[model samples]
Target: MKNDERPLIACPQCDLLMREIPLPSKGAACCCRCGATLYRNLPDSLNRSLAFSISSAILFIIVNSFPLLGINLQGNANAVTLLQAVQSLWDQGMHLVSSLTFITAIFVPALEMGLMLYLLVPIRIGLVPPGVSPIMRLLQIIKPWGMVEVFMLGILVSLVKLVQDFRIIPGVALWSFVGLTVMLAAVASSFNPRDIWAHLDKDNDGKID
Candidate 1:
């Protein structure tokens, strides 16, 4: 298509109108006004996103399935899982904190990763499923709410304080949560909405190919 007829994308930072053009596989488009990232043209965005999101999901399961920490105090042994930790907080009357912890660390991340996989898996097979627009919007809205790394940091800090009093043994879930935090970050970086739209564009008009 001609330059003027090419798709125009406004800068998300400053609303400057610019034409969106084909980019190299490793190339990125930046908003000229504020230098914010517009989009990136990564090779095989679908496959990469699918792989990372799936791995993150698995790690997330491991995080909740096993014990987060094993502790011994005065000859008593105890272990806690992710949900148990939240429950402990709630039992201590920190209801709001516990609720926030459950929502951000578990529910939001799971929902985000689930939505990502829902989109990626089908698009990998060349099918853009119904409700793509709403799912995409939901992902955007909840992406900020999935603060796994923040929760991880809080966990580590609390563990440090507890170690002075109790014999704390790191559990399988602790390492798994660490990995999940990294993998979730990878999933977010690999997933680009523009790439999904490219698929929709191709399917919308077979003549474009």
Candidate 2:
């Protein structure tokens, strides 16, 4: 098999087998028999998501700078940012959970956003992305780490627990975080891994071998 060669992937919607096409492009090659659109090209969607990702990255930085939650009791108020929350846990010697949360919630999202921007922007400008194959691999690794939805669920649970005892005020940073979570999922879904791999076959001669 050639490097860019992709076998047919069966569409669950119509049971029509579709061939994978090259990436950094848009729209789906529909099934001629059933007229079912097997897969839609999501590069455009990814562009929108990428824009939000950049904005969210900035907001995320600000969110970390300030407090995520504030607790008031006995005429004393205490607020803590997300990093502070993790650090507090670490200070309490819950090193494992702290490390996991730090990696998943902070590092992963940042890495995903950075990698996406690095590859996508160049491709958008009609340039073959640099280091195509390795970037493709990076995308594969980052895909699982884009767990914004899971993190959001955890945040909701934490919020529920906090609201029981204190008057919780949602900040701009919090809303941005929520938006960022939703956008992250959008970006992930918008990415078509096969398409990215197609771009890696630089010579455009069909056969990589």
Candidate 3:
């Protein structure tokens, strides 16, 4: 095999081996045998992913800091930020539940967003930082654990149940959380792991330098 030759890739769905083909700008390639999408070369994917990740980070800060819901019961008002909710659960002796909530709702999402920014920002400047491979692998591993959408659904269910007893006031953080969930999903969908690897390889091959 020559150094200039494009490598072959196996179809994810059917395991059919074929030479990788370059996709037109903003186009996708499909597997000939399985008719499954092989890869996509989305135009400006890096910029878009970076934008979404940054937006997610900002929303995450708001979600953790501001009150998610405010309740006025008999003229007494109480509100809870996302972190406070987790702490409240722990204070109520639900240690395991609180830990899970903290991990899924806070830690995983923050880490994922941070990693995306760290990776994408440098790559956009034509630089591949060290540990790109392992970091990317860790990103993939933790992607499903973030669970922002699941947390939102849980909040909605809780709000429905509590509406009968209390005056439910949705806070700014609640809306920010909703936007953060959408941004995170968009970042994940728009980012292609293969694209990053290909770009890194191309850079190393002196193609981009």
Q: Write the per-residue lDDT of candidate 1 for residues 1-209, one digit (tens) a residue.
A: 89999888998889999998888888999987799888888898788889999998898898889977564545677787768767766776768766876877777778888888888888888876778888888887876765656765575466447444323347678788888888877877787788788788878763221
Q: 116-175 in candidate 3: lDDT tens per residue?
A: 988998898988777887898898787666556677556545544634423334778878
Q: State the lDDT of candidate 2 residue by residue for 9-78, as single tens digits.
A: 6776678766666544665666767777666766555456557667666766776776665655456777
Candidate lDDT (C-alpha), each: 0.77, 0.65, 0.76
lDDT of 1 at 139: 82
RMSD of each: 3.6, 5.9, 3.9
Off by over 4 Å in 1: 71-76, 155-168, 205-209
Instruction: Report how far residue 158 has shifted in candidate 3, in Å.
Output: 4.3
TM-score of each: 0.85, 0.66, 0.81
Candidate 2's C-alpha lDDT?
A: 0.65
Task: Specify the highest-TM-score model's number.
Answer: 1
| Candidate 2 Cα errors over 4 Å, as ranges | 1-39, 71-76, 155-169, 195-209
Which candidate do you rate higher for TM-score, 2 or 3?
3
Error of 2 at 137 (Å): 1.2
Candidate ordering by TM-score (highest first): 1, 3, 2
CA lDDT, candidate 3, residue 180: 84
